[model samples]
Target: MDNTRLPLLSTETPLRADAVRNRARLLEAAARLSAEHGAAAITMESVAAAAGVGKGTVSRRFGDRNGLLQALLDHAEQGFQASFLSGPPPLGPGADPAARLRAFGPALLHHQRANRDLYLAAEPAPDRRFLVPAGRLRHTHVAVLVRAILPDADADLLAHTLLSSVDVVLVDHLLRGHGMSLDRVEAGWHDLVDRLLP
Candidate 1:
């Protein structure tokens, strides 16, 4: 068990430990509001009220609503990244590369589903979508695994293809418009991986 606390943000000016905890608390409150009432329900004032802080505190921490939302997304992304990077089992460090590759899809699917509203609301313009840090990180991780499993293949391109298959927007459409279950989506990932393995 790695006990290291991953920094939520990179900063030249280090935040006091208390400040870090306070910001996390506000983000947690905002996430709770988002989960319970939807992204539309999370406002600066509402987050402040939920965190038992003054609205000014929220303002100081995030600058504005968009900044707050971006931070919330980053906070969520960091946890998901950490789970695959260092946490236990097939999703994390302990499992073989092939097993980890198979696990990535379902892990990502659930992460996106849990954060669906926020992801959809904060979605960048189509041209900008693949450029986001979180998306890039996931792609890089997948590519690394693909390279390990199929060194002769174009892992970079294949990673994109694999990720696109379970893309959040596509999954939402399948789940909502086509009534496709997540289990089916996850199974599809496993099937794809099995076919790709030589």
Candidate 2:
């Protein structure tokens, strides 16, 4: 995938230093609230109370609850995106395509696990699920790698299959309902990748 396809960070837009600090403070407050209580517990009022800011401030920052949730998701996903996009080898650029493909699953699993609540809470409706920017970015990345690894395969479909195997909802089911370990799920990813190899 083209590097241009990656999601832009909120910080990309210029802001006064105090505006930047205020945004971070608001996001941090929301994150803390989400972690401690639940995503359902996060309201502009709650975040404002937590951040010691007024309700108008929260509204001005995010507009509404949905906007706040999306911004928070973007905030959280950016780090993971950066790691895979530009960080060191394996998950990043330096490793061979095959190794990078192998690394992607575990990295994604950990990222999702760490942000499980945010993902589950922000889970889009069925129709819009795959259309989200972050999801699209992942699909493009995997499809590009799949094209490199399996020249004759349906790279787009294969990428979807690989991603679905570790999807947040499924992973939660495997871990919570089925009593599967993260390591086991990660191993399953490796096995799936290996089986796809020529």
Candidate 3:
């Protein structure tokens, strides 16, 4: 179906603000629904139903199923950043760099646990020849914090390797698949950091 069928973006330029809104509403609903149910159970129709919009409206807003899935992942990433940047320390800021970085991995693991569907939906296909590159800005963020603890260390590479440890899939495998608890993960993180640092 044509996006034009849903609603125009505006009167003058032919774009519909209402449709834009409906799209955001659909994503919101999709997040909630996926969290409550599972990603496999989430459907465009379900999101539309929850958003109080037509399925066509949902399609117009997101373009298709892949678009909906990508949007959900985007939403989850934004939340992950927000939670880490501002939620609370030791997850957020108030803690020392050692403590902050120490908390970062576990906080991310916990975040993934709570938002598993969003996380799973966002994961890229494994066939890609090259791995996802680290975002320089985020690495800079980690580097700044890590540098404070180990002034002579290569914060860049450390952040690169260590940041990956926070990944949910890895945590899920190590914990659920291995029968480990959150505290075990947390302790393990501290031990690694100590060995790597000083």
Candidate 4:
């Protein structure tokens, strides 16, 4: 499937059959609507109609728009995690932690940009509110390498700094205004990470 972000649903356990179906319908509808009209155009009623299900089903499954966005974010996060943990060599498990952390940002930006509507709609009230878990995942993933290299610098801070180097605002600005190419962005990130990590 051409998923921008993969399933970030709860991994606590399996969901009920009906819930599973409803959830699937919701995602399909959200993806389609977000693509056509952008994230703002996707309403509960609209999603329900598109899914061929009841509005109540969508509301019950996701609570409200914010809740639905959160669920979608979770799914995307889970998909990202699952892929990195096992998908491929550079993006997955086989690369150096520091190197991998540097690589992840551009991929994430591209991923987010592709699903612009869903991403914009799902942005948290404050970045800290939603980015915490995602940050945690990236921080720890890089911390492993930090400990191996510096071992003296605070790994947590190092991770945070490394991550901040790829802020979307900066990326967007660089790309749109400065006419920076993706390869340049990726190369810049490489330089940024190398300097930040040490």
Candidate 5:
């Protein structure tokens, strides 16, 4: 993937140094609350109390509960994005497209599993689903890889299909509802990729 061509996933305006620190502090507090109690425990008031800030500050930083949750999810996604976009080896830029594509599914599954609660909580409405910056980035990365590996394929649609196979909601359902192991889910990803390759 050409890092230069990637979209800026964050829509927020740049903040001053202290404002950036304050936002990070708030997100950290929210994450701690989620870790300790669960996503439901992370309200504006709760985060405010945890971060030793007033409720108004939380409100100003993140418009509402949903916005706060989205911001928190974005915060968590940054590391995963960095890993695939610029970090070393198979998941990153140095490896072949096929290898990167193969590595993406398990990495995504693990990431979603790690932050399942926040993702589930912040799941966007169906109409606006694909508009999320993180989702767009994932799709773009996958499409780029697919286009490279299968030059004649419809990379855009193929990318969506591939991503849909490992979507967090579906994976969560398979895990919690149907009693599937994470290994099985990951194996399924490898199988899908194997079948797709020549």
Candidate 6:
């Protein structure tokens, strides 16, 4: 994957410093509400009330409830993206491709678990799911790693398979409904990578 050629997902213009701070404050309020109650509990009025800001401020910041949810998800995703894209060691650029790939699943699992409610609330529709910018970026990253590790393999398809194995909804089901531990889930990822590489 050509990193330089990767398309930016955002089109919004830069915000002024105060606007940035205000946006962060509102998102923090929304996150608190999400943590306290649930994603469903987040509303423009609710966030405004929680942040001690007017409804108009929330509306002006995020446009609507869905927009707010997307922004919140984006906020949660930024750190994860940065870690794998530019941060150090096994999950980042400095590691060998195989090591990086192995680290990706548990990292993703932790990320999704930390932001489970927000991710669930912002889950895109079936038709639009793969079209989401973050998802596409992940696919590209994984595919690049796959190609590096197994040059002859069907990297694109294999990347999809690898990613699907740790997808948040399935991980949630395995954790909540089937009573699987996170350690077990992470072990599954390691095993999957081992099998693929061996």
The TM-scores of all predictions, comma-separated, are: 0.87, 0.81, 0.76, 0.72, 0.81, 0.83
The 10 consecutive residues of candidate 4 with the worst lDDT sum are 4-13
Ranking by TM-score: 1, 6, 5, 2, 3, 4
Candidate 5 residue lDDT tens string, 139-176:
99999999999999999999999999999999999999
Residue 162, candidate 2: Cα error in Å is 0.2
Cα error, candidate 5, residue 143 (Å): 1.2
Report residue 27 deviation for candidate 3 (angstroms): 1.7
Answer with 2 or 3, whichever has the higher lDDT: 2
The C-alpha lDDT values of all candidates are 0.92, 0.91, 0.73, 0.71, 0.92, 0.91
The C-alpha RMSD in Å for every predicted model, in order, reads 7.1, 7.5, 4.9, 8.8, 8.0, 7.5
Q: State model 2's lDDT.
A: 0.91
Q: Which ten residues in a row have the lowest lDDT in candidate 5?
A: 5-14
lDDT per residue as tens, model 1, 1-198: 443544444542366677889999999999889878978898999999999999999998999999999999899899999999998989998898899999999999998987888899888898999999899999999999999999999999999999999999999999999999999999999999999998
- State, as a TM-score between 0 and 1, how close model 5 is to the true structure: 0.81
Candidate 1 global CA lDDT score: 0.92
Taking all chains together, the TM-score of candidate 4 against the true structure is 0.72
Q: Tell me which of candidates 2 and 6 scores higher on TM-score.
A: 6
In TM-score terms, candidate 3 sits at 0.76
Candidate 6, 1-198: lDDT as tens digits? 777544442333344667899999999898888867878889999999999999999999999999999998998789899999999979999999999999999999988987888888777899997988999999999999999999999999999999999988899899999999999999999999999994
Model 4 regions lying over 4 Å from their true place:
1-15, 115-131, 149-154, 172-183, 194-198
Q: Which digits, one per residue and each the tens of the lDDT, describe model 2 over residues 30-64?
A: 98888778788889999999999999999988999
**In model 3, what is the error at residue 150, expressed in angstroms?**
0.9
Off by over 4 Å in 1: 1-15
